[model samples]
Target: MPFYIRARTYFKYAEEQMSLAEKEKDPEKILKFTLEAAERAVRALWAIVQVEAPKEKPPLEKILAEIDKACEPDLAEEIKNHVRRIKELAQNPSVEAAKEALILSRQVVRRTREVLEPIIGPAKRVDQHRRFYF
Candidate 1:
């Protein structure tokens, strides 16, 4: 599939996972879903730029550094910082961390969707009646 399509897929999944993360009571499960949302959001960002994202959970800072080193123009500082915060919060999952993760994931995913919409078309009218309300 094309990078745009992949980006949309990840963006959708990340949003779905975020919903689960929000209602979760267990810290581990919260972290699991939070990390998934964060990683998938990062993947969407990479795909929007037509590049491959890391499959492993190496430090997000390392991955961002690699992107900065390789991509012609790095992702906006806003995205980089959000992703870094996500990684930091994921380390020690707790009620507070989960709250922060949800906030961070929401911002990053919303921004990714905005940046991708013009290139790949708006996500408002997607199939299956599934909406991504960032």
Candidate 2:
């Protein structure tokens, strides 16, 4: 599968997990789902970066460094900070931590899309009035 497709799949899973976490009454379940969602979002960002630079499957640290160079300094720093915080939250789960993870996951996904749009062009749109003549 293509990198973008993989990224989309992971992003979708992250969104689903976040939704599940929101509805969950049990704190433990919420934490579990939120953490998973955060992790998946990170993976999606990784895949997006991979699509931008496809020479070799470099180590994650190297890939992150490449992404840092490719993106604005503030955006790169935000992503790095989010990843670090998400990992820390994973280690010690809490309702607040889960919420933070979900928020950061969303930020990462938005940033990734911003970075990818230029390289991949805009995403396709479906319209009811549009028809294929061919």
Candidate 3:
């Protein structure tokens, strides 16, 4: 398929995952959707870079560096902490804690999108115009 179509599809999947995470009564599903959202976003970004920058693509470290650069230091640290917690949750998600995880995942998704906007460009952002009220 075409690059733009693929990007849109990935974004849609990410949003679906986000929605599922919010409605998740099962702890495992909550953790799964959190990861699914992050993974889809990262994969979409990488695909965009691969298509747009091809032969001169930026390294993964550089892409992550750019994301980190855009975020506030404290916010970046908090994102990291959440990532670590998500990994732990993947091993075991309790229904009570999973609700909290869903909230944290949404925050991460919002911040991550902000950090990635420059890399993904205006087209993707245009699709995300509707905000998810927390």
Best by lDDT: 1
**Candidate 1, overall lDDT?**
0.70
| Model 3 segments more than 4 A misplaced | 1-7, 52-80, 115-134
Give the candidates in order of TM-score, highest first: 1, 2, 3
Error of 1 at 92 (Å): 1.9
* Sort by lDDT, top down from the best: 1, 2, 3
Those runs of model 2 whose alpha carbons end farther than 4 Å from true positions after fitting are 51-70, 116-134
What residue pairs are clashing in model 1? none
Q: Per-residue lDDT of 36-56 in model 1, one digit per residue for the tens?
A: 887777766666665555466
Inter-residue clash pairs, candidate 2: none
TM-score of every prediction relative to native: 0.68, 0.61, 0.58
lDDT of 3 by residue, 53-124 (tens): 345645434544444443577765676676567666777768866766677777767765665565445545
What is the clash count for each candidate, in the order shown? 0, 0, 0
In terms of TM-score, the best-performing candidate is 1
- TM-score for model 1? 0.68
- What lDDT tens digits, residue by residue, belong to model 2 across residues 17-81? 87787788765677677666766665666776565546664554564565564468788778778
Q: Where does candidate 1 have its weakest 10-residue lDDT segment?
A: 66-75
